[model samples]
Target chain A: MSAPESILKAENLVKKYREFTLDHVSLNIPKGYIIGLIGPNGAGKSTTIKILMNIVKPNSGDVKIFGLDYKKHEKEIKNRIGYVGEVQYFYENKSVTWTGKFVSQYYKKWDENRFTALLNDFQISRTKKVRELSKGMRVKLAMAIALSHDAELIILDEPTSGLDPVVRREVLDILMDVTRDENKSVIISSHITEDITRIADYITFMINGKIHLTIEKDDLLSNWKKIHFKKGALNQEISQTLSNVKEGMFGSSGITDNYLKIKDKLSAAIEKEDIKVENVGLDDILISFVKGE
Target chain B: MIGIMKKNITFFIQYIGFLYPLMVLYWFLRKDSFDLPAIMISGFFFYLLISGSVNILESYEFKNNVYHFFKTLPLNAGDIVRAKFYNVLIAVFFLFTANSVIYSIIIPDKNMQVFSYIFILCCMLLTLNIIAVLYIGFFSIGFNKMGKLLWITLILWLVLTILSVEMYLIKLDANLLYAFISRINRMVWVIVTFAGFASYYGLMRIAIRQLEQNYDNV
Candidate 1:
């Protein structure tokens, strides 16, 4: 009956560039949950993650991870946080094993065996130079590093971008397995809605640096539905509750964010077979939001 | 911090490996002229060459956005800045010590007073080079801007070094300068060395602050 505690809380984060500004954005990520941040390009997802990681300073904002402030506890906070940037950066000439050894020195709880196991499982050659690996392999290497450090919170920025479907699925499955422990949390940012839908327990939709919605995955999918009805079936009162309404010769269709609220109101139309309802995918919902509908 | 230091040392080793053949060739050409001042000037020239090449390599690392990788690790700005400063200090000290030892072996006279003066001179030059490298590392505007600035700095340093050597060779007052340096008490030398170290620490603090505040821009 009690809500889960937030492992990461960000309040009114603001970062301004010459051309774009991350408007007053805020977020709360619950423990043991996967939070998928869905946004289009330049929507401030990477900027938000950078601010959270303290890689980029915000003009105005406060971020707390595990009840610790970055200003006073940067090393302590970062030690427990695993971050993967959009582009994997490493010494090109260094072997994979060398890179691992280099990174292991910085983490207090780095598990060497686990890292070696991950490298084996990911099929990344220990002696291969970083430049010799493919993009998918690079992502796996980054993921292996993130998961090898006993990190309490893993923040991935576009980790699956440009990967083949198989590799992407593997990455998602790895993330899912991480949350199975019930002590770890993940915040993954991506524009791919299907990947988010597959693994995210909570979904946050962002547009132009502002968070448009944050809701439970099941709640969002179940409550938000598309309704196809006769012209007169949807009254003005019920029509007001719907969004992205489209009228056609066959019938009119509209999306409703609160299907349960309007279920009783549409009972007559449903009973008479004058209206039909269909489940909406995250892509549909995201497209509607992106079009400013 | 140790990890960062190791990474820098690795880079130093790699660069030095590539430059070793050139260094050998330079030594072969100038081995006949080895003397107190000749050794000092050649050592200074070699320092400039190594530092310049290393600066370019450091710039390449920046261009590749390697700091992003460092930032992702559980490291604060101070750790990174200190590691960089320590790397420069250690490299300069190692080079000067090797130079002094080689000069003492090759030059038959081996005057203790002259060696002491040269040691002090090397220390001063090492301090100046360390400050220059650290300043450039922290405040590099951009890759192209850094290249241009490096060229300007290298030219200025070379001209100043050559002019000072020429002045010492030609001017009668040069003996007075040497006397002034030799006459300085041990306490003064200790204070000067202490001041050099203090400035190194102070510059490191400033670099750390700059990095913390302007990480994205850097």
Candidate 2:
């Protein structure tokens, strides 16, 4: 069987600033998948997205979208990619309809009727100035523009941050709807792990400008398990495989990333009820990675 | 490129309502005092004012993060710089045309001579405006640094322009000025205009290169 084709590939991107450096970051976004870039604040998630979009030139790296280099195919690549930045910037004095008309001129496949429909669906008024809209409305506006262009890949940076739960859910639902077409893909960066687990097919955790790991969501959840056992019940050999070990008066618990490898070794303990194994979520795994456990 | 130019025209139009009316009012109030020198000085003053107003409006637009918005679009640095250069060219063309029309109506006896002088003055103002546009395109250097540099250049240009005009008014003979204008071949005028446009294009290319190198700062 052949591997799925990638829509966007970034190799060893590095950007240096006085206070922060995006150190040798890399990413691969396959077609028909939602890839989540999860990292804390100032963890280089935004910088990585900016470099991929060619908004910020990297000190050293190669980025190819649709297998085309940015230096030669910048306009073509950008035309096919929909980007919603972390902070939405628009002509604040222009009406929504005017802004839409202005943006539609740049894309070859812009759908005006679809854009108007999205505005109605998103509850955005066509006659309102951008400054008059709320923050959530502004995000919806950005999403409406992103969706109307018929882009092959949608890249969003912190689209759900600072939003109310209702709006956040709506944004996530829109993203999910975008991927209904199997040829499309999305790469969203956020610190919110629950949202990623809910929608992302693959999650890539970044810490301190470096990508710690990228794995399928199901694989990450299945392999990383939290085990609770009494002290001395588990030997040092098994304990060495665990991380974030905490001791309580009642018992002790540790997280394991290779639960399948250690499952057979603990079969005897499981049969005797000497230890309890619990399924771990993406948040726990991210926390363990972030805390350097 | 057309889209960016259209956007710039739309932005400038928003301010034209008040600016154009004020310029006309200034000319009407001083109609009795009109002459070649007075007309030249008025044109220079209005160009300076308009250029300063444009700088302010552009600074405000930058503060509103217009560069960030444009960067997200599928535009290259050349598209942006060319659009801006076209905006200045269109603006200067309209302003000079309007001023000449107003002067022709007010000073009918000296219409031909005033028109010729205004043509020469228009060329000078256009050159100045092009330089201003090129300086404004270096906005990626950081707005504060660009702003300081632009103001210093504008002030120096203003002083030199005023001094040159004052000297020309004081030292020139009317027949000598007329003879100079007539002795100039028509082909030379065409060549000079073409050279003006060619230099404007060259400066625009330089601006585009600077913008591409420092787009992130923008």
Candidate 3:
């Protein structure tokens, strides 16, 4: 990896509240790759996006987009960046067409073709007032607006949240399309493991107010594992080998790899008795990392 | 600038078309009282003009990630503010001009005496509104911090009008025109209006920089 194709990066980023701080978080989103910042609720995902957008005041740190400092190239950076916040609130009384028409004047690269195509693809009525749209549709309309412009980097917070499974799939499909162009990239924060698994080549785990890790998807899948336990595996033996169990109950009723470890603990007889072991999903690693058990 | 400006103008025109006529009718119905029409028009103009700058809420939305949809566009934030304020001013100007013409035609003698008075009163009303908007916007910082701003504005405007009543009285008399000409000039009024507008414009810049600093710490 001779110098990853970088599109967006935040360095030593720190934003402090009375009670919480982002704690010197840094991220580099390589161009053309869909990066997922996966975290549980209250993990400072939205805060980071706000800082990157230059929406909030930062206590310390620098944000660079496409290798340009945010302070010097704010307008230029903004032109290339598109953001959809966790909560989508537009002028409720305004029609989609009115909002679209108004936004068209602000972007030099506003492609009316892409705008209309996204509107149709998402099945949002151009005549519909923003207040009338459902949460899923509101998110879809936001995505449409974010993508209509020739944004080099799209930052989204909980874009798939509160959507039905079908709608979530649709949103991810659009995201996948956005990343097909090598110059385009996305940094989406989501709780949806499946969405991250589908398109995110790079995943960063955020816990508490700080980032816990940022690992490539291939490294995660290749290294992480879920070890299953069976009856007669001594509880004391299981505890000795698997000390990092974040959540799961014993009693052999369900199949959960809460006991996943680098070393195996099951008896040789049980290992050959049709028991199963598998790689961990983001959700599993995320739970363990976040709970920090 | 043009696109956002057009949106604000479109909104103001639609709002005033419905609201102003009702205000005029209210004045007509209440004509049993002396100078109530003038008072009513002045009050409406006061709020509408001030509402242009008193946009703590609008500024909040703009400062929030809410406007990423718009800010990411080519339009500048100040352009949006100017467009909003200008739209309201245009609406206010139209109403004042129309009323001035109608009053002149209806009661030439009575209106002429009242015209200068109303003109100055409306001017003061606009100036004060602009001042109020600037102060509220500056200290409140953003819409979320506007609790005191709203109440203070209401109380301050109330206290101000009570003080300006004497000036309004002097305005209605022809002899006072000599004093008025000497007391205030066109350039002074421009300076006063722009001073208020410029001060608020400067506050917005300060707040943006402060927010950026806060963001970097996160």
Question: How do the residues B1-218 of candidate 2 rate in per-residue lDDT, one tens digit apiece?
Answer: 88878987876666665578787787688877655565556655555655665677677767888877888888777777778878877766666666666766766555345454546455555655455454545554666666666677667657766775786679756556656666778677678777777777777777777777787887
Q: Write the per-residue lDDT of candidate 1 for residues B13-127, one digit (tens) a residue.
A: 6776567557556655776665445644664565675566557666767877778888999888888877877777776665556555555655554353354445545554565
TM-scores, all candidates, are 0.92, 0.92, 0.77
Q: CAPRI verdict on model 3?
A: acceptable
Instruction: Give per-residue lDDT, candidate 1, residue A7.
Output: 96
Error of 2 at A150 (Å): 1.3
* TM-scores of chain A, one for each prediction: 0.96, 0.97, 0.86
A1-293 in candidate 1: lDDT tens per residue?
89999999999999999889999999999999999999889889999999999999999989999999988888998889988889999988889999999999989999999999999989999999999999999999999999999999999999999999999999999888888988999999999988899889999998888899999999998899999987667677777888999888877889999998889888854455878899998888888998983
* Candidate maximizing DockQ: 1
Candidate 2 chain B weakest ten by summed lDDT: B109-118
- What would the TM-score be for candidate 3 when compared with the true structure? 0.77
Q: Is the docking of candidate 2 incorrect, acceptable, medium or high quality?
A: medium
User: What C-alpha lDDT does candidate 1 achieve relative to the native structure?
Assistant: 0.80
